[model samples]
Target: MRLNTQIQGQGFPIICLHGHPGSSQCMSVFTHHLSQQYLTLAPDLRGYGKSYTRQRFEMKEHLQDLETFFKEFNIDECLILGWSLGGILALELALKFPEKVKGLILIASAARPRGNHPPISIFDYVYTGLAGLINWIFPSWRWNIETLGKRSLFRYLIQQHTKITYHYLAQDAVPAFLQTSGFATDALNQALRLGYNRLENLSQIHCPCLVLAGECDRHITAISSQETSDNLPNSQFYYYSNTAHLFPWEIPQTVLNDIDYWLTQHPEIFQSN
Candidate 1:
């Protein structure tokens, strides 16, 4: 299973993983910024983007596909940068294959599984359902933007419901998200069918970690973010003020700068446990 991947730069390899409703394309700009200091390899995870051709979506298969991706690329060990769901995968990789991970950078990630995630209130559900319907009806990013243009409901969804409020959604996120081809639906179902959540396994991961949190994020509560950092054996947690889930896209330079500072402060070369 050859996942569609994008690679750039030439230093220490940094595997980039996007969040749910995310794709490598959505991550392209972010990785490009990181490419100045590290070799960035961003791939669309299975059941997402270009890899949605599989018959079914399974958490185990996603892990296996990544393990295969590493071997196929001859990546013995490398740093990892993951967002949200991908962050969970990164932590899992570090726990399961300690030698294969140098360091970790997780953004807007939750330690607990989706069940622990905050549920959308009934009022916000209206916006979420509407957004879902729009996504279902118009897979085209341009069409979605034009369709939802300057509408109060769109604003409600962006600012209150999802808090993505991303200008790039029309150009980057929505386009890459559309490429998921409705695979997230199946994947969401698999989450319940498989009953997978590694909240109890945090201590197993020993790699140095950098956890970035958004102060204003509603998707993941501040207390949960703090608890996630507290659980990690080695982690530096930073919360950006006035930021939300789309903080990386909203302020790439600030996010990149913080990441650079964190990486520089850590061991220049990791001697894995």
Candidate 2:
């Protein structure tokens, strides 16, 4: 599969993978900021954005596509930045092809995800259900008010999964969510249900890793991210206050600076491939 990749800058490559229900566009903020000093390649993985084919993919298939993507671009080695589901893929990529991955920056992601068991509390369920019902009836996306207005119906659905407030949905994130293929979404969910655990294999990936988690993330809890860091042979973990799974957009500069600082700490990330 030839992924539609957004490439920018001209230095050591940093491959950016967006979360589930997202496209490379979701990472554009980071790409634009980081590209000033480092080359950034953000690809629309299969079944998302322009890569949508109505085809379902298993976890291994996604990995194989990434390997093909690397070959096509002659990317022998690079740092990987992944969010949520993309983080799981990044971990698997490092384990499967250790030499090709120099380091990993995980954002709101986990090695061992809960699969079908999301940690939504009873209050969350009630709140989201009522919120969703209200949105469906009144359609907040249609509101004329600027501050409270939403532009996409998908944003409403996303709020049901994450603890993020409705109006806080990042503009860039809405389209990425809307572009996601239903087949792709269903297949990934099925794959997760089958099992997405990687705790046992974290030791195999010896490269430097920086795990960033949202303190208020509902989907991938802070504990899961910390546990992933704990298993990794070499890793650092940090959590942001008042942030959820969408922290990248919520605090773009902070996330960018943290990544830049981490990369600077490990000069090996800039070595020629």
- Model 1 agreement with the true structure over 1-273: per-residue lDDT tens digits: 678898899777899998777888777756888888778899888867887574765666778889999998888779998887788888888887888897888888767633233444665556544554565455434554443432423432233222233345555666665677565657756764775556678888777888887766665554566677788898888887766666776567788888888878886444444
Q: What shift in Å separates residue 31 of candidate 2 from its native position after superposition?
A: 0.5
**10 residues in a row with least lDDT, candidate 1:** 156-165
lDDT of 2 by residue, 204-266 (tens): 998999999877677788889999999999999988877667777667678888988888899
| TM-score (all chains, Cα) for each model | 0.80, 0.82
- Per-prediction tally of clashes: 0, 0
Q: Model 1: residues >4 Å from true position, as ranges?
A: 113-165, 192-196, 269-273
